[model samples]
Target: MHLIELSIAKFEENLCRLKASETVCSSSFSSISQKLTRLQDLHECVENFLLLPLTQQALAQECGDKWINELLDGSLRLLDVCGIIKDALLQTKECTHELQSIMRRRRGGDMSFISEVRKYLTSRKDVKKAMNNALKVRESNCTDKNHETPAVVNMLKELDAVTIAVFESLLSFIAGSKSKSSSWAFVSKLVQPKRIACKGEEVANTNELEKVDAALQSLVSHKSKKSDNTIQVEDVQIWLQDLEANIQDIEEGLECLLRRLIKTRVSLLNIFSH
Candidate 1:
């Protein structure tokens, strides 16, 4: 039990650090990916803690009417969120590959290029819509009924809260920013002479994806010269390729993490079902 308590404390500390380091508004693709990895680590610890004999005995002893119901519900919601996110990533990846192909085979002012950009943007809008729907699942599920539960149950509840928080940030990053000004700023920066100087920092900032998003938007919406449009298309293609690679890595991580989440949920069910 003492060891279980220590493990839970360490998990909470890691969760606090993750929250402090990245936020929904400012997180970059890479940072959010790192957060996903950290979340997996935390869940692994949770699985081990749950497997302990003493921990199982304690959980079995509890009446666990409200607390258990909330946890089981929260687990179901987490699974739902994970599946949606994975599908979104796959959808975005397909759109990205299509856009990259369009950019590769075509040059300036091609009607197909413009068409593909519209499709990609539309896909992004759909993805964000789905993510927002999933996020409505309620963090309150993790916080309610905590005060009256055992220490182990409280720890599990806090873990659920932090897990949901991480997923929320991940979903937000994938969905991109909703603010018009923020999106416009990325577009504006893309055409600037100094944008080349800041290329190194793009991966570390939320604007990495936004840069490609804005560049494509600018290409289609602006009446720039053919040569300028070609250059922008090339830049956008490179960025899209990079994003596709990152998305693949993140998708792999999410799949692994999803399995861990399922395993943890199953463990909980087993403890009380008997």
Candidate 2:
């Protein structure tokens, strides 16, 4: 995902440079074409990652003992790459607009090129929304109840670290820019605490397994009361199965979220290159 994002940014940079120039050269076209090819390959890789099975047996066999930590690390890298790609895409849109304005001032340049750029921009926006939603879902589901397993907690902590790194990078990137003071300052304030809070939650959850167990027991007991003693036994059994299934689902969801984030980053790279 990082590779894809970097390629995309390079592509966009080239695009902007080419647009700014009075003449379009063969080398410029070749660069854009190569970036486009790489973007497509990166998209395929993301799709393959998503299609991978998330079962413990599969993960163990494929990634061994370091699966969880490695997955988390990869996810974080992808998030950072995607974030940068998204920013690049936004900048690309502005560059395209400037190019359009320049073309409009020229004698015979076609204005329809602006419409094509708008179409790509719209697609990029949709991808960004999807990535944001995926992240939100992952954050929402990473709770004590759903992620009580030690492995999951550890993985989440690693993810949190990655998130913090990405957030800090973004803060630095924005701070270094000459944008409006209030806007960048506000973004910095908003992101810093969020990164801290996310990391804090992971730490809290790691040591709160006993509490999670207690809550699970309470939920089971409360639900068991809805039926007679004899029926409650059967219900309890069914409930336990359901609970396990829910846990598994949550685990799978986490994996899916990670994959989606990777894909999002790759897509962003594609947009940047375009």
Candidate 3:
């Protein structure tokens, strides 16, 4: 269980950094690399010892079995966090790369241009609403001081901060390009220019062109239905909502199981003293 617990703690620390900063740097990924190493080691350690008969019997003990259940439940919640954070990281990384590419491109219509700033502003508001809804859910289930702050809430805050930074940078870039003739488009066009057919329709290289088109179609056919480029802001907001609900359930399980473990430990102490 320490494997899961410590990994979660490390993840929380990274999320704290994200919540406090407007940008993610290479430093964040450096820390993540160390975390992945630790997780891999822990997983190997668990597998090496988990199936022993003595270990199985100890896990079956009724006096403290609730702790085991809580640990498993917590691991599931942490996996949910892992999935969401991975998604956010990949999205932010791609967005950062594309924005930089556009920034460095020669000032012309051939590179790329973003949509209006107002649309970005609306998307930011929608993200804020999602963050608020997550908080509302936490407050609804939390009954006492002990249940107030779950790891999920802090994690969601990081997600909110990262998302806001993404849109804010986009808005700034689009705003600055307003006065340029080359950046006059409403929607963006990628750096890859459209293909143009040969003029005059000569048949000298017809076979080679057909072969190239066949190769290109073969490459394009392998693309999946769910590409990152196709995901919407609304899709991310929905994912966050699902993550928040999972956190709520995990927190309840942790509290209940922790109370049981403490009670069992106290009872054992009493029996030994008598």
Best by TM-score: 1
Q: Which stretches of candidate 1 lie over 4 Å from their true place?
A: 23-25, 137-139, 142-147, 201-203, 223-231
Please give, for residues 111-140, the per-residue lDDT of candidate 1 as tens digits: 988898999988888988888877775456
lDDT measured at residue 193 in model 2 versus the true structure, 0 to 100? 40
Best-matching candidate per lDDT:
1
Ranking 1 against 2 by TM-score, winner = 1
Residue-level lDDT of model 3, residues 143-227, one tens digit each, is: 1323343332332233333333332332232122212232212111211123112311332212221122222222233221334
Q: What is the Å distance of residue 198 in model 3 from its true position?
A: 52
Candidate 2 structure quality by residue, lDDT tens digits, 149-195? 44423333333343433333323222222233432332233224444
Ranking by lDDT: 1, 2, 3
Clashing residue pairs found in predicted model 3: none
Any idea what lDDT model 1 has?
A: 0.78
| Lowest lDDT block of 10, candidate 1 | 223-232
TM-score of 1: 0.90
